[model samples]
Every structure is written in C-alpha cells, then in structure tokens.
Target: MGSPNEMVYIVDDDSTVCDALSSLLRANGKNVRLFSSGAEFLSFERGDVGACLILDLRMPGMDGLEVQKLVSNQASIPVIFVTGQGNVPSTVRAMKGGAVDFLTKPIDEAVLLAAVEHALEKDRIARCEALQQADLLARYHLLTPREREVLPLLVSGLLNKQAAWELGITEYTVQIHRGNIMRKMKADSFARLVKLAGKLKS
Candidate 1:
C-alpha cells in the first residue's frame, strides 16, 4: 500500500517518456504527477509531504540543472536526474547539487524504483528534521529575554550561583528563571534542555 501523501513528480518533455515513467511508479503504488517542462513543474505549488522529482536532464527550456537550482532551497523534494545520455560532467554536477541519483534512459525499472524509494525516505527524514527544528524555534521564541540569556549559561554546566554571579542577579532570581526556562522549553531534564540548546545553536 502507498500513501498519496507521498508523491513522485516526473518532469520530462516527451509525453511518451512521461507516460511510461508515470505508469511504472503508479504500478509500484506511488502517487505520480507529470509535467512537460521545468517551468510547468515549478509553477505548481506543492504540499508539504514526502516527495521527489524525476527530472529529465535535457529540455527545450530551463533544463534539469536549472530546475534543480530553482528547487534547491526546498529540502522536502529530493531529486533524481534522468537523461537520454548521462555523462560524467552532468552526473558530477547533479550529485554536487544534491540529486539522490543520476539515471539514464531507457531507464532500468528496478534501479529507478530503488532510487525512488531511497529518495522518498530521504525526503521523509528531511521533512521530519525541518518540523523538529521549527518546533524547537517556536519553543525558544516563547522564552523571555532574561530566560534566553540564562539558557546557554545553565546548559554550559554553570551552577545557578555561578550563573547568578555572571549575570549580577541574585541566585534566587536565577533559580526562578531556570525553572521558567525548563517549563518554557518543555524540557523534562537538564540533559534534554542541553540537547535542545545544542540543536538550536547548530
């Protein structure tokens, strides 16, 4: 079974190529979308989900590399470049630009499916990490100015008294801010708070 929430996008100028690739992916229980050109593909707004692009390397206008550039900022959609004749230069460029795989036509069914599976999984993990980063940022935004200042100090293993001295605040007040930081960050333990802080810094 496959979830429609996971999509496979095919962008090829040739209708025959598009139809064949779409059929193969659909047979594998994947939801497929087709486009005649990179412009068409980029214009369509995509939803947040697990998805990947099967891009034809050569096109009449705005080739695969151009499309890859357009979508480079979007981490949710991983890419696989398929060319009539895949070359070393193109393959190297695609890999450097973060394509999951570089494929040539007439493509092998098993290899294409494998690459698609890997791409879907990559997209899944990327989306998950992005969601987690967003959640962490939201939580961090809820902290007060003083709480924000104390977060790094306490996470750096400073004693409350030491932190109080650094900030020129009473230890009692530092303890109160520490409690607020713990609650605001929704951290169950100091270790978890430290981990969250590390993620934010990274």
Candidate 2:
C-alpha cells in the first residue's frame, strides 16, 4: 500500500542542526518533521507515513542506537545515523543494527540528500513487499483444506495426474481443487501460483 505522504524525520538534540537539516530537506522538496529527542520521535504515530529517520547517535537520553532498535521492532523504517563523534565501533554497531547509512557531522548537503532519497526508496519497496505479503496471506486464508493440500504438490511442479496419484485422489478431483485454488488466489497461471507458494515457503 502507498502512504499518504512522505516525511523525513530528524531526531537530534541540537536545535541548530535540526533546523538546518529541516530547511535543507524542505528546500529539496521533501516533507520534514523535527523531533528534539528520541523520545519525541518514538511517541509519534508511525505506520501511515512513508519516512526515514535521520538520527543523531549521541543524544543524551534514548540514544540513536537505542532508538534504531526500537524503530526496528516497530516498523521497517530505514535509518541514517548522523554522529559528530564518528567512532568506528558505534558506526559498525549502527550498521549491524540495520542503519541504512552512517553520516558524520558537518554533513555534506549532497550526501545527506542522497542518503535520504535512498532510505525513502528502500522504505517504499519494503512497504510494497509487506503489502503483497498481507494480500497473499488473505488469499491463502480463503483456500479450503483440500485445496491447501493440493497446492504444495502443484507448486512442487507436480502434474495433475501425479499430484492426484500422490494424494490418493482422482485426477478430476485434483483438477477441481486446483481450479478453486487458482481462483481464490487470483492467480492466472501456474507460474504465478508457484511464485505465491514460494513466498509462503519463505
């Protein structure tokens, strides 16, 4: 599903840095939200917005890394860490914890813009995949027990006759179940059904 708006959330205790980054992002045609602390950022309603977090790693309470972990559990919003200290261990830790980019202080406008764009695109793609998965689950819920049993074999590339034999059912019955599965899934072709089955497997 597509979000109603795209926002770039800036979480930095430094008011000057927050204002500057907000101005720069707004000038570059992005919607921006500024939070003075990690706590403020965390408290916002998150799922409806298409956004990435620009977080300063050295905040006083609820530091950036902690915030990243919190957001990681809440949603798949991409994060770009901004740090004045630029310690290697912290950078590595942030990266390992799924921060999309680690940026240093005195941020380069071009690099920052590029990072924001990349994070937003990544979030968009992830949200789309999540939506697809939800749709797949809903379709799967509509399947009958027999259809569910036949689906795995069909997806294993078994022919109707083979699947029928394997399941100890008549070929006509297998065909009927297969037709029901295809209709329920809204899958127009066997290849599409296989793809859906692969998603379920994963």
Q: Candidate 1, residues 93-181: lDDT per residue as tens digits? A: 99999999998889999999999999999988888898999999999999999999999999999999999999999999999999999
Weakest lDDT window of 10 consecutive positions for candidate 2: 1-10
lDDT of each: 0.92, 0.92
Give a tens-digit lDDT track for model 2, residues 88-192. Answer: 899999999999999998999999999999999998899898899999999999998889999999998899999999999999999999999999999999899
Q: How accurate is candidate 2 locally (lDDT)?
A: 0.92
Please give each candidate's TM-score: 0.96, 0.93
List of clashing residue pairs for candidate 1: none
* Model 1's TM-score against the true structure: 0.96
Once superposed on the true structure, which residue ranges of model 2 sit more than 4 Å away at CA?
1-4
Quote the positional error of residue 119 for candidate 2 in Å.
0.5
Residue 26 miss distance in model 2 (angstroms) = 0.9
